[model samples]
Target chain A: MTRPDPESRRNPPGAHLGAGGSAYAFLFFPMAILTVFVLAPTIIGLGLSFFEWKGGPLWTGAGGWNLPTFVGLQHYRSLLSDPDIRHGLINTIAFVVGSVPISVLVAFVLAVAVNSPWFRGKALVRTLLFMPTIVSIVAVGFVWRWVLNDSAGILNWFLSLLGYNDPPNWLADGYWPLFWIVVVQIWRQIGFCLVLYLAALQAVSPSLYEAAAIDGATRLGSVRHITWPMVAPMTAFLMVTGVISALQVFDLVFIMTGENETRYTTVLNLEIFREFSYGSFGYAAAIGVLIFVITIAATALQLAAFGTRHPKAAGRAAK
Target chain B: MSREHRRRAANTFNRPPFAVRLASHIVVYTVAATMLIPFLWMVLTSLKTSGEANTPPSLSNLLPATPQWSNYATAWNVGGHVSLLDFYINSFMVAAITTVLAVAHNALAGFAFSKMRFRGKAPLFWATLLTMMLPAQVFFIFAYVLCSWIGYIDNIQALVVPFLASGFGVFYMRQAVTAVPDDLIDAGRVDGMHSFDIFWTIVRPIVWPGITALAIFTFMNSWNSFFWPLLVVDSMKMKTLPLAVADLASAAYFTDYPTTMAAATLLVLPLVILFFFMQRAFTQGIAMTGLKE
Candidate 1:
């Protein structure tokens, strides 16, 4: 038995459906763009993290890529030891972990509620749920910052009416900065999650619910057993995407948290921003690399345990 | 399955169901209000004078006491270097060019992936999906890099280039293409149509609506895009709506409420209008993607 050439089989020169080899170039566009924008830059980014780049133009290399300089372990060392980066990592994790569950659960309940007849003006409700999702994050963050302002802000004004003297220093205190960031993140995201959950719940078969009802399940019971399992894939997707987004959560955090200080409100993106803003390209890139590593590890662990929305064999097996 | 279970089920669902439903109505309405109030605030605030804006937002101020329509004009003209018209021009041109290129590339590649027997096709598609999972984090420098390499960074193309062949577009369009009957291609061939002709004259229209939805999404994303433009293009001359509006808001010392409102309202109105018109296509197109793939 002759072994087929694996290389030729995979690359079959100028391969096509019928016109053979004529369509081979079609692959080049998508593949080339990927190489240029994604693969090549990523490889370059991996290398640059080791060097000390004085951010000017990427090519001019104000320069530092050496071994004692290469300190095979130094980039990793700096990433771990940096207080701001460390705080950012923790904040990012907390933000994701905190938001994902609340958003997903609230959204799921809202979707189920909307799917029922008791919810009148469903159209208006849906539009309301979707508005924040469509609005720019900057707008949402900025507006909410005003509303959540410590003194003379809307929340505090209400608190004053309630006879409270003080409200939280939302963007100021180290603790509440983290708290406010989470609040904004969840506030902006809950609507989006609700929409996705609604869409998923819309796909749930009524027959299944009816069967659950006939089987003597309470409304809540059916929700727990029937609805929950059916929406698991979406829940998992929300979780994964939530985790992934939370890891890189930048915009609202940057805008809402105001600026970086000992507030420990900085995340990886902010850390990178600090580096880049101060012309510490390599150091920022190092932070980015760490983020990339964490993302991969986290996502892999998630996929291993939670079976993603990818309905292919891997997902099926994971389930 | 049992008599006891049946009795319990009947009692639970049948008892005070009207009251339960009424309570649900109140609960859902409150939840819905949470989502809707912000936009109501946006509209109300747009009508407000600078004085109203500093004070807490309230429904009583929903309609500005003395409605000032001039604020919109102020926003339009405040950044005199480029007016709303210029931003509109920039937005349309960028969105139009990006949508066309992205849809075209997606169509061709999606067609190939769906129909053609390419080497490593599965792996290639998988790689594309993987790219979608990669965070938008690393993209901070994509525009800058592409520009320095091609000297197009500050140019309008900077806004249009990097996203031209979107991964999700390809994934979606490929799902649409595979549903096209092979016999249709054979019939086209039997009618003496060229393959390119078949794709253009036959397949394009069938997928045109699907492509139209993709175009709108691409357009919206490109139109509202902030970060990439913030990094790549530094000049006020090339500002898109989001960038210009954000600048207007941030630069306002007294939080130039009226002008900023006008700019934001102008920027968002077209989208709101566009969304309403194509809302059905947009929703159906989105719905179909999940169903298909």
Candidate 2:
């Protein structure tokens, strides 16, 4: 709704001075940057994925138009055959499935709790819960890695005091590192989702709850019947964005599991980083394209699901 | 009805029971505390000695026996090869310049998209929106190639030039600009004010809060950014704070816990301070845009 309709706003020609020229002038720089850095690279990245190149010029020709280095579908075919790449892709999917739902659910619960009319310290709680989202991921990753250290970690030390003789290695043991990575990701994500949910929650009309109460609805009944449906748009938004981010997770996983090269914790972006570092440019671009395809597909699927159920909400989301 | 009576009528009658409210409070506080634990531990470890940092945690040993204030100094100048100060300077310069330029470019483009008529307006706006949705990962591979082609692989320009504009910034500012009343713009035009001048003097002030919010978000994002810097920055001299802190933590020769903690704390300190000062605008910025960097 904040987007003004361009067609309806057409004034008579020459009624506005400096409008036409300045519009182009204003758009020139950002659009140029986007065209070169974002638009062109995406097209080029797709092209690069089909060809084999290692850290240098694309082809041995006058312009890169010659098809000497072209290897059609080779990188994509290799991706299908490669075990490590498949595992990395599966890990990313699992990460998205594991983290996105839990984060959105937990954030909704917290937002609902803190948005209660009688809730004390709402602002304080909001501030505290939202802190982690704004901080440096590397710093937080290091702190968690230290706190979850096998022998010297505060977690194990706390576990020992609580009458447990053995606490599993959180970062080193099989599956535990992946599990903790998901947990840390959820911890980081809850705040942003919570803030969005809180904003959505505040916009709900109190009169609806009052009306439900008068109709013999309990607090739980009211929330289930009214509040849940109302925040569907926010939930949809959170899920799409959350899945997109969860699929591309790198910095935290890299920081936590880089020392061990844990197979379970390796996600798509990490694999992409590794390929790029190894000078496998075409293969890396192939993986990048895979991530893009998955991201677009997931976004489209969510929008379709939401559109069927909440058409207006889905329309907003499409923006 | 009196005003107070009207307000009382607006209150919902489905308030939870005392026990239920108490339980909800406990759950909320627990989650909030969970969010604070890592930060508190980071600060605590930074002040402790290496021996104390690695020591078993207990009620008595929670605080450092005597805070080692010098760990920060040690962390700042780790080895002849790596220095946190250099990383700090690199991060500040890049983030500051990027923030200023991004605000101007995004605002101007936002104004154009929102109010001005031009050729390719609809398609251009759609492309901008598409850029907002597309993950930055999609472009990284070829962006690297392009940067290298332009002879900027290891240069600081790699950090700033390609990233001087953002789809989110443009979109957010478009919303802000759209909210400005048409009368103000029309009046400025009547007085023969140029579009740029009107944007600067009239519209900018109206959306100053939004601008500040955008600026804060841009700064924090640039400061904390890792992936691009990781790709382009091959030398220690060009490393940003995130890269420097990650390197420091994972360095093969480095097992100094307190110093590592100190370095982590220093990396996170600026934004933490900035958040406390601009918490309102910052959170509002996130809520307004419904996006995170």
Candidate 3:
């Protein structure tokens, strides 16, 4: 309902003095956001990593943490040694490895399918396909949970219809927990990648494809020679964002897995949440710090590849 | 450019050529249908009563056996004590405030980066780019503790304040601002106007479209954010739509699937409406990113 501002007041303050002050004011809001949401928790997490408390600010120091004791790296040792944590870590990796490539592949196929002029109703199909992305992941999790419900659920009904006598416990079973979770994750994330790929595919210069056709090239030849290099940057961007987003994956896992504290889907962040819930603030902080460290290292490698110098060198190598 | 290439490619899929066209259409439609069934299922289930929902397997389950439209009213009423309407209000407020503030900050930052220069600008921009890769969860555990220390924990500020700064928004707006001509600002400068005047008079009006598109996405994000909100929001009073509806879904054990589906439908209404109204902006917003245009 808000109208566009009248010309008089709608204008930015270009003539205003003290660019630094205005800049500071501008920087203030965004920086404050990052400070509160990101930096502060990170600092507090470091302090908490060293101390042990049971559900409170009052540090008993019983765990040998400095608040009263010294439990140097004891939490880390326990976390490492615990088979559950080890299993959860493995599960998290299995999820990342399983979902990321497949989602990317599906997205690419969908993009190509919709991108080609050979098909009618591409608009309807693309919207329908991308529709899942906008739906709440939490909602999607619950819906899929119903679909996968072990008893009286649609999945089992369909499987039995297909002649399998028994459909395993979708949520409770240890076996396909990773599989179902990955399926939902891929479903939710595929839409974003599809949009990205579609954009990237369109950005590809058509003249190159035409030139390739003139050279007696096949569709595969055009994709290999022209399409691949053009969209490589977009692919690179998706990978970097995809990996980071994957490592931080929580909403679907949290909702799908539910309040079973001992569930196998717990990742590093979940471990931190669990530790905090258990009143071992220090240990939780350490786990968070460990996650941050690994993330930083991973992101650095990703950015380094995206850096012009490295890629240029690689391009030189290819030639 | 070459009829021969088209003909040669046609040979692989079809010796007759007309069959490939039909085959492609079949493949595309099949993929589309696979993608749409979940949404189709959600709406169909919403109209059914709790009793019908508890019943297993029936594509025959399409229409409610006994339609209970009252489920919408109850779902709205039962939503984690916050209720659907209230959650919508709270969500709208947070998203609105976040969008307004983020747009203002990014517009200013983008203008400065594009037009004004002091020192270390590229480095500062690069630093912001690097921050984009930060996994938010890595820092949130600490952020929670820090918020608690500052008495911001469980406060709506915890819900809203931290989301206003977005590096990608700034980056995108900066690109848009750069497309604004330097000569336009120069003409204003010759009129004895200052830099701020130039930004207000020339740049902002021109860049408002970009600002608007960014706002929609930002609003969508704020409306749907769960993880951090989950961390801070405990009271029913502060619950957002996703949190409230999710609570309904989680607790409904032998309860009616119809009611849960109704609840889910209501939850998504605001987004669907917003997207429908501004769909042109959203699509144009994405299409702009293709870069070749």
lDDT of 3 by residue, B261-288 (tens): 7777886667777766776676667656
For every model in order, what is the number of clashing pairs?
3, 0, 23
Instruction: List candidate 3 segments past 4 Å from native.
Output: A1-20, A43-48, A51-72, A160-165, A261-263, A296-319, B1-16, B79-82, B119-127, B283-293
Candidate 2 per-residue lDDT, tens place, A1-319, comes to: 5654574367532246334587888889999999999988888778888887775554647665423268999999998988778878888898889889999999998888888767899989889988888888888888898888876778887789889968887887888988888899899899889999998987877767656766777777666667877889889899988888787888888888854555777888888888888988888888988898898899899989976878654343232
Error of 1 at B177 (Å): 1.6
| lDDT of prediction 1 | 0.68
Worst 10 residues of 1 chain A by lDDT: A310-319
- For candidate 2 chain A, which ten residues in a row score worst on lDDT? A11-20
Model 2, residue A26: what's the lDDT? 88
Q: What share of the true interface contacts does each candidate keep?
A: 0.18, 0.63, 0.40
Task: Rank candidates, lDDT, best first.
Answer: 2, 3, 1
Q: Considering only N, C-alpha and C atoms within 3 Å, which residue pairs clash in candidate 1?
A: A14-A21, A66-A70, A67-A70
RMSD (Å) of each candidate, 1 decimal: 6.3, 3.9, 6.5
Q: How close is chain B to the truth by TM-score, in each candidate?
A: 0.86, 0.94, 0.87
Which numbered prediction scores highest in TM-score against the true structure? 2
Q: lDDT per residue, candidate 2, B109-196, as tens digits? A: 9988887877788999999988876666768887888888788877899999988899989999999999998778887877888888
Per-residue lDDT tens digits for candidate 1, residues A1-319, read 5565685466442232437453455656766666566655666666667776553453445564322134355777877777787788887788778877888788788777776744567767766665665566656655666566553255676677688766667777667877777866766676667666777877766656556666666788667766777788787877767777678877677656544445377778877777766766567677877778788898898887766334453333223
Q: What's the DockQ of model 1?
A: 0.29
Q: Which stretches of candidate 2 lie over 4 Å from their true place?
A: A1-20, A57-68, A311-319, B1-7, B10-14, B252-254
